[model samples]
Target: MIVSDLWRYPVKSLRGEPLREAEVRPWGISGDRRWMVVDPSGEKLWAGEHHDMVTVSAARTGQGLRLRAGGRPDLHVDEPVDGPPVEVRLRGVGHAVSAGDPADAWLSEALGRRVRLVWLADPARRPMSEAHGGRPGDVLSFADAAPLLLATLPSLRQLDDWIAQNGGGAPLEMSRFRPNLVIDGDLPPFAEDTWNEVQAGEVRFRFAEHCDRCAVTTLDPATGRSGKEPIRTLARHRRWDGQVWFGIRVVPLNEGTITVGDPVRAEGTRSSR
Candidate 1:
């Protein structure tokens, strides 16, 4: 198999930027989900709770961060090198730095709700949830769970076929699932479900768990609108233990750079690394 795509979300719950190459860190891809929007109480906010969040696109600018959405001028904010620290809850309460009131006003105005832009500052602040098969020292960013999620084109095609068979409507875009890596090759559909480990480019990663679907996956990234095809279809075919599953989460065993077209091989077992 070969790596087909790479993406990094500079901010949680916002549309991410696609990349041809990225540095894979133990926590996650560099610049991936280092920031998030949270309520004044420091609770996390997501597109599932506020669909308008999906309409906003966040990218890393040369100096700091840039946010854009319809009907608003792109707002740029420099990294808050000296900003006040704040505690925000991800998997657990962790620390972050506020991007100041200008960013807050811009994001709040765009989403029609009061929220603040907070940088993770330290991606390792949150540990992966042990309920999802995490072990000690497994760190994460603002990503909902494990460091990287991998989705395969073959599996997506399988899901599309199921959707068609059930008359569930249009095939959904992979972006709805927001995987960090997309791989394509001759593997059977959902083959990744059983993979114990895999290597992509120079990085080695162990399987963490299957990614569970949520309302966010039903929202169209372009319009912040919800649908009921892929999730509905997955519920019918991929459900188990009261949750629908899609991509697989992976924890990097070694950090390095992975690029599009990097050959990927299922290692079948954890590497000595």
Candidate 2:
């Protein structure tokens, strides 16, 4: 039971980057989902509705951001060029703040709409999901569940096997799910169903709920193309409760740096009541 892979999506609903080590924050990993694209109405934009483009991968470079895309060259933006203030709804919470402009333009052109980028200042506040026993006022992080989602290699392999048998292509990489962590070791597919606590390195997270699949999963993160195979295959065997869940959501109990290759351990049932 060791940590096999780690990832972070600098922007919401877009391609993510693998990380060797990541700093966990109250909302999520430091750079994970800190920024988002919004329409002219200030409503947030997502890959599900507008799949052509909506994400911009970036890194902190000396107080600036270095960005990259599938076919575009790398872009750099220095400070001083401030973005507009806007409110964005995640899950169901309204996060208000001003953000950087370069990110806004980059995302707007990608989606061919007027969109802006906004950042979260109070990372602890979240948009609670109805699936997670949350109320209108019950704030949640930017994630679907707690703060992170974890999956195992064996579990992914199981899904791949199921997909192949059902005429779906090769099992797509875990990146398609945009999980924060990928663990190794022999575990049943969707074993996260019953986990309550998961330990990785010095960090411990409380497993709270299973992540439901969405149209975003059908879109290719790399090419932004959508298909029905994965969704159709998953529907046959992965449907649970009233929704189709595929990953486990977790809330961090202990905060610390988590790196790849760390042993992963789970305690408790693998099924939800």
Candidate 3:
């Protein structure tokens, strides 16, 4: 198999950027999910709760970030060097420094809420969820659980076919799922289901769990509008344990660079049980 596509979300829940090559860190790819939009209480504002969040785009640069969205001038924000630290929670409250007022005011106007932009300088501040297959030392960025999510093209094609057979509209794009890596090859649908470990290029990853589908996946990324889609179809066939699953959540076993077109080998296959 070969790596077909790669992406990183610099800010959690916002639009992500495509990448040809990425530096894989312990928490995740470099510059991924280090920033986030949070409510006054320091709770993360997810796209499920704020649909407009899907419309916001955060691009990381050598200096910092470029924020873009409809009806708003692009705003540039620098990394928080001397910004005051604030308490924020992913699973639990931790330290995250502020991105200052310009970012706060800009995002507030865009989302039409009093929100602030906070940066997690150190991802080790929060531990991965043990309930989600994380061990004592596993770490995560602002990602919901694991460091990376992988989706295969064959499985997606199978799903699209299912959608067509079940009274579908247009076929959904993989972007709807926000996977970090997209793999392609001649393989059966859900081949990743049994994969316990995989090597891509020089990097190795351990399977954490199957990724659970969420309401945010139902959003039409192009329009920021909601729809009943992959989620609806996933419920019919992929549902188990009261949740619909699609992609695979993976934690990095070694820090290295991964590039598009790299060969992927699924090694050390093991039972999920």
For this target, which candidate reaches the highest TM-score against the unseen true structure?
3
lDDT of each: 0.88, 0.70, 0.89
Model 3, C-alpha of 212: deviation from truth (Å): 0.9
Winning candidate number (lDDT)? 3
Clashing pairs in 1: none
Assess the local accuracy of residue 85 in candidate 1 as a C-alpha lDDT between 0 and 100: 88
State the lDDT at 4 in candidate 3. 97
Indicate whether candidate 1 or candidate 2 has the larger TM-score. Answer: 1
Q: Model 2: clashing residue pairs?
A: 1-264, 2-263, 2-264, 3-262, 126-140, 126-141, 193-270, 194-269, 194-270, 194-271
The whole-model C-alpha lDDT of candidate 2 against the native structure comes to 0.70
Model 1 deviation from the true structure expressed as Cα RMSD, one decimal place: 2.8
Query: What's model 3's TM-score?
Result: 0.97
TM-score each candidate: 0.95, 0.87, 0.97
Worst 10 residues of 3 by lDDT: 264-273
lDDT of 2 by residue, 1-273 (tens): 778888987666766778898877655676777655677676767778888653556665555556677677776755323554566655455655655666667766656777876666556666556567443444344555566777778777888898888777766877778899888887766677778788888788876577788888887766778889567877888886666768787767656888888877899755453
Pairs of colliding residues, candidate 3: none
Candidate with the larger lDDT of 2 and 3: 3
Model 1 segments more than 4 A misplaced = 269-273
